[model samples]
Target: MAPNLSQAIERIDAAHSEDPTKVDIDGEPTPYELIYAKKMSKFLELHTPNPDPLLATAARAQHFRRWEVPRDSYPRTKPGYFAWRTFLKKRQADQVRQLCLDCNYSEAEADKVAALVAKEDLKKGEGKGDADAQIIEDVACLVFLDDQFDEFEKGHDEEKIIGILQKTWVKMGKRGQDLALQMDLSDRAKELVGKALAG
Candidate 1:
């Protein structure tokens, strides 16, 4: 990573460190958002090792200080869920953009990062803007499947789980789908994934 981007990532990481919500990682206490960001970054690296600095910044800061936006604060309806998600994407992009600008990156560079974080124009297989954005989405899906799906499965019913699996599968690329299928998921979860894909 470039020096400026390294500095900006430090800034973002520091902000996430302040989150009050905590999660245990191998018996170590870690801030929830920090772990999430790290997972996103790791997934991005595994998905594509040579991502540009802007994409890397977007991945590492995609959930910057995300605990500030508690899910319960929004209504429990579908529209409310969508609204909160949109708010998070925009907020994350804006925060990362400021960090990039503060670290002396050009406005265009920062804007590209913002666009990637917001996932403004992602497509299947174009270069740069479109493909980079899709990679980020693929990383997110991979992280969710690997890290959060068990917890998420607790609240939703079978039908809902199937729907979510389908939605997540659609967001991912071929590599991510293959990786997910190869995960050591519980039998039930694997069955649901298989069902979703079989459809």
Candidate 2:
């Protein structure tokens, strides 16, 4: 017989009960910690057609880490900040790419997955101002390039796409620099100012 919802929930609870590390202000263990501890069991229980546990876990961890690192502590200089974000983004993209591969996605589909990652607004609905908007736009442009490259590979219109991408890159570069200047960056990050200015 198929398991009932209560039975499934009980199993999840039991798996979590086996280990408890991190906790919230009220002393409740975080779901992520629980998921990490009981990944295998939880994977089996929560198996669905749409989502995979491993991918979900990786994404969740990335999201958690992003917020955990205080923005003030981030690299202040332009190059430093760019390098830091580049490193973080590459790691995140690698994980997503692996997930796509495991899910049997084609190369084109995998590229789309990477593009989506670059375009995603990690800080959506946060009520921030123009700086946030600029970051989002710049990141989206990066994603757009990835997608455009994929289109080029498929023999689609190239000249028009290149022109559009060039224009977008110029606009995003300017906006990124403006946003970067408004914040206090580290000396290392400052080096990225020139690159951002030229972008």
Candidate 3:
């Protein structure tokens, strides 16, 4: 990594280290968002050959100060869920944009990283879109599936889980889908994914 990129990632990790939520990692209590940010970087590195510095930074900062906006703050309805997600995307992007600028990235570069963090112009269906943005989306989806899906599935009903899986499948590009297929998910998660793909 370039010096600037390494410094930016360190700054992002410093922010993540403050997350109040803790999870066990190898018998040590670790900050949840810190773990998530690391997973995002690892997935992007593993998937994107010679990943862009901006994309790597965006991935590292994807959930920048996420715990500040708790999900339960919004209503449990679908519209509320969408609103919360929309608000979070903007908030995180804005925060990371400023962070990038503080790290000495040019304004254009910071804006690009913010746009990638916001997932602007991702390839939703078949039409062409920004390759870097798509790669960021793929990394995020891969991280969620690999790290969060099991606990996430336990909370939601089977129908909801399958629906989320299907939507997740649609958001991913081909590379993400193939990578997801290869993940070593538990039997129940595999079953849910199979049912989702079948539909």
Q: Candidate order by TM-score, highest to lowest?
A: 3, 1, 2
Q: How high is the lDDT of residue 66 in model 1?
A: 75
Highest-scoring model, lDDT: 3
Off by over 4 Å in 2: 1-26, 31-76, 120-199
By lDDT, the better pick of 2 and 3 is 3
All candidates in order of lDDT, best leading? 3, 1, 2
lDDT of each: 0.85, 0.42, 0.91
Instruction: Estimate the TM-score for candidate 2.
Output: 0.31
Q: lDDT per residue, candidate 3, 98-151, as tens digits?
A: 988888888899999999988898864668899888889889999999999999
TM-score per model over all chains: 0.90, 0.31, 0.94
RMSD of each: 2.6, 17.2, 1.8
**lDDT for each residue of candidate 1 in 1-199, tens digit (9 for 90 to 100):** 2338789889989998999988888999899889888988887887888777888888988777778899988999999999999999899889888889999888898998999888888764443447778888888888888788888989999888999999888777788887777778877788889888887
lDDT per residue, candidate 2, 1-199, as tens digits? Answer: 2213233234334434443345463675565434432432232233222333332323222322343333456678888787767766665556555555555555555454444444443334434434323344553444333322444434635445445444554546454434335534444333333343344
Error of 1 at 73 (Å): 2.3
Name the top TM-score candidate: 3
| Runs in model 1 lying further than 4 Å from the true structure | 1-3, 124-129
